[model samples]
Target chain A: MKLDRRKFLNMLLGIGGIGGIVSIIYPIVSFLNPPKSAEPKVNSLKAGLNSDFPENTSKILKFGRKPVILIKTGKDQYKALSASCTHLDCIVQYKQDTKQIWCACHNGLYDLNGRNVSGPPPKPLEEYDVKLIKEEIVVTKLG
Target chain B: MKKISNKLINWIDERYDLTPVRNLLQHKKVPMHRHSVWYYMGGVTLFLFMVQLFTGILLLLYYRPGEDSAFESVRFIVTEVKFGWLIRNVHSWSANLLVFFAFIHMFSVFFSKAYEKPRELTWVTGFIILVFTLAFGFSGYLLPWNELAFFATKVGTDIVGVLPLVGEPLKVLLRGGEDVTGATLSRFFGIHVAILPAIFSFFLALHLIFIQRQGMHEPEKFKNLPEEKKKYIPFFPDFALKDLLLWVVVFNILIFLALYFPWELGNKADAFAPAPKGIRPEWYFMFMFQSLKFLPPHLWFIEGELFGVIAFGLIGLVWMLIPYIKIKNRQNWKYQPLTILGVVAVVFIFIMTILGYIL
Candidate 1:
């Protein structure tokens, strides 16, 4: 069957219009529901025993290069925050007296709870789910 | 009362003549032939300014610009205010983009003869707007009061101190003291929110007015009009709509990049931590910052800093004066080698900016 010039042109326009719409709409929808960044809740994996963490201090424990700020708040209770600033990913340090995470790059100060206090930082440090399993500390990266 | 209404209507009708403004602005019709995407740099700059203004007001709702309240206020916004973090990011990024596009727009206009005859005032006002924009960046950069802000301001303002004779006074004027502390933050905040915006709006209105009065500069071929030809179109339904559409596209693109990549802010500045190894100025200043590297300690006994400053001032002066620089038929810049220099200059700036970041 021979396609007429008008029909061919209509077909071309229709294809082009659909392509344009998809190109614009798909990215927007993908942006709105971006791929999940955090690990799914799972059996908490242990980092090390209580003796490894000293009193009134935190250490950056590496779980597959996903750095966790493990703070031994009390003898039994431990608090954890991501070791990076949410603003730009500069390493954050644990503040002992105030019980906050501090970043040196921008003077970004974060409380133990991972809340941003000051500077050009836009977001708070991410907190991790720190569960004491048996005698070991298991810190899972939290969203 | 009836006579008064008639007289008022007549007065309003006479002064508010839409035709002349529309005739001159004629917007899209005026430009006639802007084939490249780069031609929209000015419009893009305008678009980012709108973004900055909108998001800035949103930030102002929670931001308290002072020593004691500043840090806490930012904390409150991040955790307490709904979607405040997102708004702040958009505002900061948009401010940077505004400066970026303004530079591109200014240079493009220079090489294209867009700042030519009857448009010199437009050029001057545009230059002033650029200055106000730098002021906006300087002021806004200090508002958060973190360590980076503290040290960056200290180093940045100290550079001003290297000037001969006026250096000390200028630094004091900027910081309100020997160091950049609370006073400097407050002053910068005031300028960012109030004075700079007011001045920018004044110049922006004038710039738009002149752009309207002169329309767009044509390539040499189209400078002369044929007898009785009226090819110009209305700005509102036609060009303004197109501008708005393109603006929406740019906004969406910027927001997407901001969210997905999420430009990193440095860790909270630790006033105690040694300054970051290689703190540098924002992208727009990298050229001048890098330019300083090439200069000698002193230009024939003149302080290097002073001579460097004067030298840049001269470059800017030349840039602004380009439209007045006469050339043969000069209309077709597409083939001109001098135009090639403008492109090279822009590329060099980009390379230096990236190098500054990497180094």
Candidate 2:
């Protein structure tokens, strides 16, 4: 094929235009994605002392941007799970009467094991690891 | 210098045909009439919006959006940064003036019946732009995180919550959660800086393209005149120079207002504090805000606020579709219904706005 002067110039212009567009878009796309500093990777948070959370009671504490419910099932036994309901993101509460997690927004229910058992919740609640370190209850998010 | 410029122009003209562009610039004409003054309104609005874009970006350099830092960052800008106060004030004043001139441009088009027939899409696009401009004001208001802005946003979103089925979810989505918090500020910041500007630029481009394609809307009286009797000036230099002169005047006014009465940061928002007395939305929104205030708590079977919202939505829909509305005119009729409706709308808005400030 013959590469005429006009055709060569046109190809160059097209390549230059694409290069210009990419250069403009690269920074914008990168800037829009929040930097690592803005969203700290908080894997573990010291919730509170075990005594403050009595047995059969649950307390919602801020785990980064999300709320984690820490429930004391029994003496020296604790369970931690994400408080955001799978249905609509309303903070789920521990229903002592039913011994289950309940979303008040839509009556979505989850068992003590964080399994979605009933209502509109399509998935189970995420469970976290609970450890007692020097009388402080620490909740660590599991992968 | 002239020879160099001419040579450069010829160099580009050789590579690409510039006839269409040259013809568009040199041959385009703007109608001359008493109402020609209104033509400058749109240009002034566009210029002010450019000012907003420039100043908004400058302020963004120092403005951080978060519950803890939003107010403090703004305070730092005005107090510490060099000429930051001037940039902030220009942004605020120019935003208000942009909305004000947009309203004038819209009303001028309406009174002149320029929205009829071929220019319907132009009107629609222009209407959408006005709506987006108001949304810009509403979203940008909360970025400062001041007491007035926070409370105003709360009230604004609460009004959105009063709608029927979608209201609750929409309000939640807008607030990012149940109530106004740091999350809400982040959402508004993204919307004000990114999403709205993207969509607004698309519609603005379409609006300007349509106007360029069809040229300016000549008044009916001017259109009816003989071709020799009608007067027009070339848009390239004559009309454009006048537009530039008006922009300079408007810019001076904006600077005067910004310098004389600089925008205040007010107190940092305390969510728990009882909202301060006389919490009001911005002046552009006062008409609807005050009208909603005058509504009774309940109107018969339905809630008054809900009724007002629905009524406003329907009225806005009708106004947007006015160009498509066909009203047969009986000969010898005293007044046009649409014209009367426009006048009534103007008067009602003016009265409600005044009452908003006073009562």
| Model 2: CAPRI class | incorrect
TM-score of candidate 2 to 2 decimals: 0.73
Each prediction's RMSD over C-alphas, in Å, is 22.7, 11.4
Query: Which residue segments of model 2 deviate by more than 4 Å?
Result: A1-143
Q: Which parts of model 1 have CA positions greater than 4 angstroms off?
A: A1-143, B1-28, B34-39, B224-233, B263-265, B268-272, B294-300, B325-341
TM-score of each: 0.63, 0.73
Q: Write the per-residue lDDT of candidate 2 for residues B159-211, one digit (tens) a residue.
A: 78878999987887788777678988998999999999999999999999999
Clashes in candidate 2: how many?
Answer: 0
lDDT of 2 by residue, A36-85 (tens): 33545789999878777778988887787677888899997989998876
Winning model by lDDT: 2
User: Across residues A26-61, which tens digit of lDDT does each residue of candidate 1 receive?
Assistant: 987554332333543453457789887787887776
Q: What is the C-alpha lDDT of each candidate?
A: 0.71, 0.87
- State fnat for each of the candidate structures: 0.03, 0.00
DockQ of each: 0.02, 0.03
**Worst lDDT window (10 residues) for model 1 chain A?**
A32-41
